[model samples]
Target: MATRQLLLRRAAAAAAAPRGRRGYGSTAEYLHRSIVPTMHYQRSLPRLPIPKLEDTIRRYLNAQKPLLNDDQFRKTEELAHRFEKGIGRQLHEQLVAQDNQNKHTSYITGPWFEMYLKAREPVVLNFNAFMSFHPDPKSEYNDQLIRATNMTVSAIRFMKTFRAGYLEPEVFHLNPKKSDTELFKKLIRFVPSSLSWFGAYMVNAYPLDMSQYFRLFNSTRLPKLNGDELYTDEKAKHLLVLRNGNFYVFDVIDRDGNMLKPSEIQAHLKYILSDNSPVPAFPLGYLSSENRDTWALLRKNLLDNGNEEALQKVDSAIFCLSLDDFPVKNLVHLSHTMLHGDGANRWYDKSFNLIITKDGTAGINFEHSWGDGVAVLRFLNEVFKDSIGEPAVSPLSQPASVDSSRAVQKLDFTLNDALKAGITKAKQNFDTTVETLTVDMIQFQKGGKDLLKQKKVSPDAVAQLAFQMAFLRQYNQTVATYESCSTAAFKHGRTEAIRPASIHTKKCSEAFVKEPSKHSTEELQKMIVECSKYHGCLTKEAAMGQGFDRHLFGLRYLALSKAEDLPATKRASSNRGGDLCQSKAKLLKRAGTPA
Candidate 1:
């Protein structure tokens, strides 16, 4: 009894002791810990400030001056004045109130969301972006086993770094203030969420819902009648491999949810390669590559026929790993694979569709709605850099001889004659579209930003001007040009459109088209200098979120919101066609999409 009581007291004492102190001998030792874990800085991040109304209006008018004729400009300027004093002021006030009341991530969140999420079309290449990696020169594309294993290991390592809160926050322009707005971190989280059944993450409980995360590691997007829906199976512990137009599912994780050994991952790849199967009558997956509404209708037909169970296997898998038989020779060619793979082999909606070619080259086709290029680039950069730095350390034993005990199942569909015809039509449409689109890859062997610096011209502006010149040469005309500028320096901010086609750019483009050698070197250089300066200024304004687009967008929405509150008859009879609302509308319409 005495010994039992002593043991109980010892256990109690240990339980009561503080964990840090128990392990440390000094104050520094006890208190010293990770100062900034991966997401630690998120809470302390400051909110994006609202830009003044007058500043935005003035900037908006300036951007339009280059696009509109004198009479048109006059009408726009008059409207701007009225808008500033009338409904514009009221709307700005409301936006300020709304922003202050809820303190939402950004003042323009409502407008941005409306534009991004409420669009009628599917958010593929038009809204989404893709990127490809430099192929591994060390190996042939046929060495899929080694290449895939490297990619898997690199990705796993990147995730582990993120989980440990060590992933570096993206810094822009070497400004500490800019670093305070770490939207890139949010992008990383967004990717996993989009993949994981559209799950939401609470900030405090981050890395929240491990089951949801595990599902994301094995999730895909399903085609819906409207938009796309994410499907993540908590029970799925593997990736779906697509080769020769056939689908195979296998494990990449153990029962405890840990990623399996690299050798095991490679073995799975080998099995998929060694095995062969007959191609289906039609590549049904190609339907997703068609128009959004078409995919929607087809999906309805699919679900109505009780093929949901079979489709679930495709949708619930983490992502499609396409084993292409073609070689990816360069960045441009690899880019093509990432943007539009063999339409038949790709499940385009997956957030992370990895395409590996027969040459052992690889690229990623990411679904865009989740985040922007910068976010994915950061993740890819880490993986690529890590892969290069770390030597390929293979395990001694080869997974105890390819464990085929995984729940490997082939996704089979019962396609009727109607579905087959639909697929055939989809293929034709896809082919026509592919043929119409021309992607020219240019590699400037010598001149780059350094040359631009020496010539005292902004690289971005020069590029935009080059496009203008090229367009004029091709079509014998000029069109309104746009350049996207990041507003990510603000909290939850996205982007703003900077209209690069100014009077100076137009004059320069016309001069080049009319007679390339007529203008002396000095005269051409002067024109380029002016265009560069103009572009740099506008781009700066956009980054500050004082860009005309978001501000004008806020006011318009605010006016609409107020109109919505009134009776339908009152809203209809309010003379919206008159001067009051016309200016804002006309100005915005002329500028095109502000985003």
Candidate 2:
């Protein structure tokens, strides 16, 4: 009991605590048996708190000091002080009242939503965040059909775990429940609606709000596109398969939720490969590969005609399966094919798009807006463990049973001459865009996170510092750097930007780069450790919803609120201040979001 109380105290002081300090306590006591219905703990989770205006102002000013020149920083400092004392105070009170009124939602949720949807121009999946699986070697070098069959069976079994309520809740490293900050230790129950991992999911790849997802369970591909119209036979259990700029629907599941045998799935694929009549005529999926505004306009045009039904068939699917034309044996190349695809080969807008290569390689192209890496990663780990770690049968072995009751369905679209022309243009645009991207894969075999443990340094901080140090060595100067830390420790949490390239990090990197012979190994290690410790503190604080970026967001929000109530002259002045805050906030956004 006393030990538990001690841990609680440590957690409370963690946010504002001094850096480079250790031996706080063990996390063993924080572990407890979670109750049933893992998601039941959500509504009861504590709301994310708003930091004090004074504290935010101070932290923002300090973070800026290292990044800004003398004159720019002084001007910013004066404005910050004035804003805090004058309009900023009023805004803080309003924010407090807003927080009080919004008992369920996070304080930053509304502002973040606008930024996520309306504020950002391009679609997020391709540009912001995505993940691709490494290719399965046996599948890549051998039988493609049999490998995909094994993969599908494994995936179904994994999904069954989620449906069975046997999935364990995720634990936060920090025990916020014991601290002053309210946080749920078991995060599975507290995921926000935006990041919820259950039930059927979809990804809208088109920037213009085109809903396109191929349901993986209990659906069949429709035959014939009659005048821009699409129809799917709901009774046929098939998965939508896209390959070589063509779409085919093949059965993988039955009506009673039973998975088809591997032989049955393989046979279906064989039939698909033999069919040559489905000309890759209209690369309709290629429209999604265009620029955000372009896709939006094109999607609008499609919807204006009688294309909503056709779009819905693709939009409401469980997931998409893409059979790629590439037969590469290399892992990175296979991963790239699965992730981005040759542009035209993917719908690019599904919550999950599983890619299978001709040589039997397989990987998933996942959309990021659905959930964080934690859930998806856990899902993939389970899939690989079932399929590869302990296979029911070797992918090389043929299945004993083959369900030949169903035939593979081809989805045909009815398109006008103009729509056909649009498809051609989209394919060209996709090719042009893909040609501009440069992909580099690096493998470091020496040491990884373990090296950080050996140094007693945080890996995140050290990795970030390594980049800044690299830039210093190569370019001889430090640039603003941003590292994202997960706030999933809190209810409905997303991410917080941690400015890892701080004042101390700059000093350490400069010392090493400018005068390598000056500092001894001991001295350099000590400095590096200090920087890492500071970064760890900032990350913890941000997870507790006390980071400078969100605080700045709140302050700017308040400023906007107050400006509306002011006269024209005062409003203009307030607008100018708001503009400055926005500009300053952009500097906080840097290049260190972990994939």
Candidate 3:
């Protein structure tokens, strides 16, 4: 009891205590479990296969019980549930085997709607950390109905469809070519009204080694939901639930039929389970959507549900982070340094971190899923070059054969000890290499600003301005572009590739080539304002439409526009660290590299 008290005390101090709730049932109470820091130990599962996309996804969800609660947080226009003044707002079929004429749908959902009705609202924050802006914050490139790129929106839809800890199961559909834009949007629709987000989990790619602390989730205590069907209406709001109960909710993709609920139930174990869990449970710890006070209530009432939350197994995801906090420890500080590193530190670091820094605003209002470290870096690079007269583009890479796409697919390796060790070693070695040459900071900006300045300021200048603040103002470093105001962010057409299927380098290529360098900063800033008119995620619709896929597409296709020809500079320097991960390390180690 004393130990528990001590832990609680520590958690209390972790973030500021909320004004109202205090104990077990308080609005911002802490859960019993400690948040598993995002750091991975990585010693275990050395032999486990580096997970494929689907496996990695499942493993991630299995560890996070009730996975729809992904890394998604919302800053509602108003704190009131119905939006006090009320402003703007606002699927089916597969007859594979039975009932060709009239197909019946069924469900077996808990009384979530009633629960939602019970919501006492000034406003409640539904911050799900697991939601990814899949295809990206920009989705125009994919089939609008979501058949093309594996973007973020559809993943959330899959969760709402089953609610059985739904994950992005690898779906393979023939990618037929189509030019009818209207037909493209038809494939990606989801009834938002039908799906209600449970909670959130800011997702991170688990490292291979640390997966052991969660191996019990592999083939463990998952309940089978069988193949239950979800029913919804026009607006997509969830109305009711039906139950088919034929399939187990936690069973593996090919393994759901492999086992049945154990007939020999142990009375003692059942007693223990029941004793621990409270029926009619709520998502422990209250939050007024997007409020920092949410952190205060994170450590209470966490349930194991007995499986890896990543969905690798049924009824067995190992719970890592419970509330708003990232699960890892001291590394959070390090992770923060890497993820939210401002100034120069921000330039050379990246991590899938959960710390929330201002989005050029006052406090925490973002879902890590919106744009984690990698996405931010990509956004920054684009912003930087755009700030110059260079065109806002990432070079596209050569397309790989479909089979190879799966073969060498990038893995979200866990940030375990081994990888950490590898980074540490690399950093040491890297420090001994790179040479630095000083460039005038203000001069660089003046030069870049003179290059941009010819566009409408409508909405996106705000976000681009946020990105711009980093270099122009924050870095105190010089960029070649200077606009009167920073352009805000918006979702642009994902039409970077002339061919939807092929990859395109983001810079120095034909697809979305970098702009040619200009003679003055003024011209650079004008191009940026013009570019901002076209891109940057300024609105919810715009933010939801884009994803990291555009960036991914670029990495794979290896094409680029001329202005972002940083690789050439590196090549001229005989350097070897232009890659995102290594580039910063190279920059950090700039002082020691041999000429």
- Candidate closest to the true structure, highest lDDT: 1
Say which candidate scores most in TM-score. 1
Estimate the TM-score for candidate 2.
0.75
Q: In candidate 3, where is summed lDDT lowest over 10 consecutive residues? A: 238-247
Instruction: Write model 2 residue lDDT over 278-373, tens digit each, in one string.
Output: 447787877755555556666767776777766665654545677765587575675557556766567765556777777766676665443444
Q: Write one digit per residue (lDDT tens) for candidate 3, span 382-486.
A: 222221222111122122223322222111112334334433443333233211211122224432432343334433343344444444334432222211110
Give all candidates' CA lDDT scores: 0.60, 0.56, 0.20
Please give me the total number of clashing residue pairs in predicted model 1: 9
Off-target runs (Cα >4 Å) in candidate 3 are: 1-456, 476-595
* C-alpha root-mean-square deviation, each candidate: 12.5, 9.9, 27.6
Better of 1 and 2 by TM-score: 1
**In model 2, which runs have C-alpha deviations exceeding 4 angstroms?**
1-35, 124-128, 134-143, 172-238, 251-253, 261-263, 273-279, 329-335, 390-393, 396-406, 554-595
Reference-based TM-score, model 3: 0.21
Per-model TM-score versus the true fold: 0.78, 0.75, 0.21
